[model samples]
Each structure stands twice: as structure tokens, then as C-alpha cells.
Target chain A: MRFSALRVFREALTGHKGWTPTWRDPDPQPSYDIIIVGGGGHGLAAAYYLAKEFRRARIAVLERGWIGGGNVGRNTTIIRSNYLLDGNQPFYEFSMKLWEGLEQDFNYNAMVSQRGILNLFHTDAQRDAYTRRGNAMILHGADAELLDREQVRAMYPFLNFDHARFPIKGGLLQRRGGTARHDAVAWGYARGADEHGVDIIQNCAVTGFRIRNGRVLGVETTRGYIGALKVGIAVAGNSSTVMAMAGLRLPIESHVLQAFVTEGLKPVIDGVMTFGAGHFYVSQSDKGGLVFGGDIDGYNSYAQRGNLPVIEDVAEGGMALMPMIGRARLLRTWGGIMDMSMDGSPFIDRTPVEGLYFNGGWCYGGFKATPASGYCFAHLIARDEPHPTAVAYRLDRFRRGAMIDEKGQGAQPNLH
Target chain B: MLIPHPILGLRDAQEFTYLGDAALIDRPDGLANPEAFHDYLYLRDNPAGIHRELWFHEQGDRSWIVVTRNTVTHEILGAVLAQDVARARGRSR
Candidate 1:
């Protein structure tokens, strides 16, 4: 029948493995100006930057699946730069600026709601740590406010602030940290980049890189054998795999994180709130649904589906914060793979190989840092220099012990 | 919150009544004797004398306890096994 809808249905049911590209008498192009692998947010943003900012035409953004099909559409949609890490400070703070101007830049309504975010403290030590973080944020020119019991009570009166029991001592409030629409971010960047004459290639898988003497010349894809003067690797955790094809390895770990949203209610949660004593955070979406998330599943899995323990743990935290959430049923839950770096940050810089660049690893905070990531990564690739914002996030900082280490956790998934 | 009896090694679980520091910091004799919140009795915090102290049902595990303290310095001496304090409460019963 050759129906487009029927083709999509059949392809989806077949695990999407069969949908790999095919080269039947593939045509050969002389060379593309630039080739971007993995058309996720980072890749799409890279294409946009290279085209719009650098004025580089003949660029291609190749995706193995549909657009907005990867982590771009799979994150918890939480945006905040309230980190205690060293390198992350400038990087994410810069992202906050990009987020502020995104509406006009992309001409797309990203639904960036600045509902504020509060990290609750349960004990004296925790309070002291968050207070230090808040002060540090202020010193770094980011807005982080410390709130006391009375302040918290006045802010959210529905809280069970049994001062004697779970003593609602205080919290760290990041005024600039909030949520944004994830899909819209993808679409906005995509439409903007595509408008600049960047070829948005979907359903095309780059099978291997055609490297000559440790330098990438082009990529061999099932769609066709296309040569590019430069190649950019923006794939998240699968970064190591692609780089390995070019005979290189990066410090990247692929881990799974899950997010859950309850059925719509009458705007109970005004802002995002995270508990220090427990692993839970909750925020209300624009649709009146309480979107909540918790710690990663504490294990390495290619499986992008979350297990039961963390969900229960997060639900319990939501109930503890606002007992009223117990009445709202959990509507849907999903998971995404995160490329966790050793320092819980990202690396956006050119590679040792000529004409090759890599951008991956933002850990759990990638959603909030999207704009900054794209802009900074683009500067690195376009200008052929270390980005001013991500200069500390070089590939060699891990060896120098100059890691951001915001949570004081080590460079491991479980520790982070 | 302070329990009138020991819990860990004592006879039985003496219940704990949750209250603030202002209600139970000045005297311990009031706890030994029946009194009201406005009776103006609180933890003694005495050094040489047996002191009364407050504890909380944190985590809601419900382990009864009695805290001893130095009345002069406000230093907590020890929170003993409340079994004996529970026995005292049972004997009074």
C-alpha cells in the first residue's frame, strides 16, 4: 500500500533496527563543509551555531532516528544552574543567559517558566552545606537565596512544617532556576538551523568514519557515502563508541535516569522543590501536572527504562512534601540514558584529531544547560578555540584534579 | 519531646510527649511529679543531681528514651536505656 502511516507503524513495531539506512548505488558528494552526528539537542544546536554564527554552509545533521527522538525529548525538563562545581559555574551560568534570550532568538515559545527551585535541608549539616552553596552562587553572580522556616512557610503554606518533627529548618532557593518545554527547544533549534540551509538528515545512520592517518575525512552512512571536511560528535554517552571508530576513547559512562508525572491537578506545586534528606524533587508543569523526578537508578544500564525502587522513593518524597499528591494518580513514567562524565559536567571542545570535535556529558543537568551548551559548543567548533565559558571543561582537566565536583561526590555514577 | 522513662535497657516503653525547649529546659523535678505545661517545671540540667532531658520520636521508630543532663552547663550527660525508666513508670502504675 506504501502508506506513510503504515510504514511508520511497521517500522516502530520492528524495534527500529531495520530502519537503518541503505545505500543502493549511493551517490558521492565531493565534501560537506561539516557533518554533525546525532541530531539531538546538542547536535541540532551545533548545526545552528555553525550555520548562523560561523556562516558555514553545506552542513548535515545526521540522525539515526526521528528528530527529537533521543534525550532531547526524554529528560525531566528541569532547568537550573545552581551547581557547586568549579567548571560548571561559568558554563551553566552562561546557559542561563542564553535561556533568557531564547524566545526572541529562535522565534519559538519554549514555555520557559521561571517558577524558582528550592533545595530543602533536613539537618544542620545539610543546611550549612546549602548555605555555603548559596553564598557561592551569589559570588559567582548567580541568584541563590537562603530561606528560613518562617520564609518557607510563607512561601508554600501547604508544607507539613512540623518544626519539632521534621523541622523545616530552611533551604537554598535558586531564583533563576526553573523549567522549560523540552520538545519546543528541539523544534526551535531545528527550524532555526534548517532555515539556515543546514541539511537535517533523519533516519540515516553513520556506520563508520572514514579516517586517514588518525584524522576524520568523512563518514560512511547507509544512506550514502558522504565526505566532510570536518565531523562533529555530539552524541551523549555513545560518544566513546563513535570516537572509538576514530581510534579514541573518552571518559564517558552511560547511565539511566527516570522521570514521572502525575495526572493533572489544580496547580498545587508552585515551584520546584528538592529534599536533601531524601532523593526526590517535584515541580508543576504548565499543564497543571506535578512533574517529579529522583536520583538515578544507581546502576549502569543501556536499558532506558527505570525500575521500581526509585519511583517509590520519589513518590514517598512527594507525599512527604505535599501529602495532597497522594490523591493524584501517577499518569506516566519514562527514562533516558545520560552520559555522565567524571566531574558531573560536560566536555564541549575540539578533539586531538584534526577536523574533529566532541560535545557530550552534562550528566543530569543537560536540560537546564541546553542553550549554553549549544552556544558554547558552537563557539568551540566555529572559532577553533576553547570556549570562554567551557575553558575549564577541557578533556585534560580530569587528570589535573580541577574537576567541578559540585555535590562533593566522586567521579562515579553511584557517588554522584 | 521528652519521655518520662528510660527505653533502651529499661523495663518497658514509656511514651514520649513532643514539646519545645522552652517547655522543659529549666527544671527536671516537674517531670518526676505530675504537672501541667504552665506549672513552670522543666529539665533541671543539674550536675551532681539526676537531670531530666527531652528527646524526639525522630523517624517515628518510637523508641522511648530519657535524657540526663548537667543543669549548670546545659551539657547532655547521657541518654540512658529507658527500660529502668519504663519500670519506674510501671511501678507507679
Candidate 2:
């Protein structure tokens, strides 16, 4: 059922008995026109757009577990498009626009908060880099403002601006960048897809791909064998393992990226602030908890938990940026599997196997690119062509020496 | 995590940089063979249990070391200099 103020009022008056499940739990059909692997935000959004935008039917999204159990639910929920490279800027900008209208388009409250995001720069080199990045963002039609140390001090006076080792010099702000309700995005997309006659099958783990003569026919799942003419795999952290089932080695590595939340306090952080000297980024949640994260646990693994070293590293970065964080107690922490690509970007392209497609290698950017990733992936699947904004996300870019090295960290997935 | 270094006793993991799968050390030479390079670059056995990985003591001794560890439990089995390992494998320089 569509949620609205009127509906809430009516339900409140009538004992709220009319509310229904967000999405149905139906058995997978024997065959479908298209099947999307992994029911995270990207897969669900792809299903929703495939039905709504592409006007396609007989679509199914297979989830290994319940919806929002993966990275979509575990991320820090920050969203921004302040990228420098041409291969990335326009696409993320498109995602920002999609996030802007996502709630209204899906008729659900995804809590699309555009509170703004700031990337702090501590050194002269960092300021130069951010200057270039900010100019690139402005050129790509995205908002950006470079603030000096005094201005940043005025905004966040509690920060450790005078730290001896890594003093805060300035920051690059994107007024449109912010966080959202990560789980709500998945639920909203799932509900929207369900409304458009798309099947969302949960607890269905894909064990193998049913391929014949290098062409995919369907998939072998824990539930049963489900047939599909076209299949799209968007499993974020499990990209390598899932594609390995089809005998395809992806240019991706799985790493555990952890996020943490602190005990609830009064609203303090005005916007998301990323530490320039290190890898820490933090934002205050609506519930008053400080949400933050740092670099990925720099190793290849499929596990959902991380070692203590990365935690200590993240804490150090946070403390270096804001000494006041020492007063707050960390409530909990979580880890998400990141599909880190060799070039530090993502891939949304067709695989070698005919009728099979792949969309992964999202590193830490998947949550922010959820909407555009699905839209572009759906476009690729439906039209057999890459979206204009996503043309650089081809699978053969590395092979052809046309890699989109956004961070210039050549071939190191962990650094990305 | 405390990594027991061969020279420095026990060093905190924060001082080191992790690089997955020491198999990267055996990187194939020559871009002439694209498939071989692709296999060498992309394909890796991401085992859940025991693994051999490379860790650089960037903030300490500036040495590259191979650490046998378990991915599942985050246990460090042992650590030795990667140069020593390479020498033991009969490689010079």
C-alpha cells in the first residue's frame, strides 16, 4: 500500500489494520524475462526501473537473505557527487539528481536528506587537489564551495584545528551532498518493484549459473532452478565468487569496510565531514548518534567482520580531526564487503557469457551510486548498450589500457 | 592485531600495509600475453581459511614481509621477510 499523510491519518483513526507487508514473499517462477542477482539497493532499484522506466515485465530479484541485510543497510548512508575525473563526475551527478527525486518517484520515505558534505583538506597539496576537484564538480553542473580554515573554524569550532601533525587548513563543501536512510532505500525500491509486478525472491542463494555454449540460460539456486533469458549479477562484495561460479574472473577484490556509531547525543555535526589527513569520515545521524567510518581493512576477504587494527586506525583519524569525539562512547560497529576494483572505480558492463551481465566493483561508493547504478545497469540489460554517463564503466577498459584510475592508485583494490 | 616480525619482535598492524595474496609476488612478466597478464593480475584464490599475504612495514623497518594468516579468524600464523622468502624460492633481486 502507498504510504502518505492521509493514509497514516486514516490508519491511525482505524486501528491501522489495513497496512500490508512492504513486499510479497512469492515463490520464484520457473522462467522470467530477466533475473537480477542480489536484492540490495542496486538490484532492487534496477528491478524497479526495469519495470517502471523500461516497461519490462517478468522480472525477478533473487536475494540470498532478507532485503537490506547487506551493504545497503550497513553503510554510513552518505551520498555525494563531488568527483574530479570525467569518467566519474557526470555519472555520480546523475545519481545525485536521482537521489533528489527518489522519494517522490517511489512514493516512499527514503529520508533523502541533502544536508551537505564537506571534505577537509589539511595540506597545501590536498587543497590544490580539492581545488581541481571542486572546479571539476562545478564544470559538471554540481555545487561546490571551497572554505578556508577560518570559515571551517566558524562552522565547526570544536574540531582540532590546531593539531600539530595534521592541522585543518580548509575544506571543499558540496551543499547537495548528504546521507539518507540506507535501509529505507532498499524497502522503497522493493515496494516499488513489487507494485509494478516484479517478483522479489528472498532466501534464494545462487549456487551456479546455468550456461550452455558460453550463454547463460538460468541459475541454480538453493531454493530451486529458476530460468531466465537474461541475468544481471549485482552482488557487491561477492562479485568475484559469484562470477567465478560462471568461470569468469573479475578485476575485483572483496574487502571488509567497517562503519561505527556512537551513543546518542544532541545534534552536533551540521554535515558530513571527511578527514583530509586520513581516511575518516563522519556525520551525525537523526537519532543523535555520530556515524563514521574510515578505510577498508586492507586485505582480500569475503567475511563481514574486520580486525582490530582498522578500528584503531579509524579511531586515530577521528581523534585527530575532532578531539571532542573522545567524550563520546562508541555504541556499535559493522562491516560491509566492498567490491574494490583494480582502478578504484566501478564496473557496469556485460560479461563474456551471452545473456549474462555484471554490475559491481563499487568499493565504498556503491551506497552513493545506488540509483544511477541500477538505472544504468537496467539500461544496459534492456537495450544492450551502456548509458551515456556510464560508458567508461566497461569491463574491457583495463584490458584496453583505458582504465578510469580515479584515485591513480594503480591496480591496488585495497587502496581504492 | 600484533604481527610478530622476524626482526622487530611484535609490531602493531597499523604500522604495516596489507596486500592480499602473496601470489602477487609471482607476477608474470611481459604484456605480450594479455591472457596470462589478465590471469596473473585479476584471478586470485580468496580462501576463507589460511592465506599467504604481503604486508609492508612502511612506518617501521620499510621491509616487505610475507605473513601466513587465516582470513576467517584474523589469526597471524607467522611472518618472514618477503626478500628472504624470494631468496628461499631461489630468486635473486
**What TM-score would chain B receive for each of the candidates shown?**
0.37, 0.93
Instruction: Give the winner by lDDT.
Output: 2
Off by over 4 Å in 1: A1-30, A163-165, B1-93
Cα lDDT, all candidates: 0.71, 0.92
In candidate 1, what are the lDDT values of residues A260-341, reduced to their tens digit?
9888888767888986767788888878888888877654444677667678878877777767778899999988877766
- Per residue, candidate 2 scores C-alpha lDDT tens digits across A63-127 of 99997799999899999999999999999999999999999999999999999999999899999
Alpha-carbon RMSD, each predicted model: 18.5, 2.0
**Which docking band does candidate 1 fall into?**
incorrect
Worst 10 residues of 2 chain A by lDDT: A300-309
Calculate DockQ per candidate and list them. 0.01, 0.48
Tell me how candidate 1 scores on lDDT: 0.71
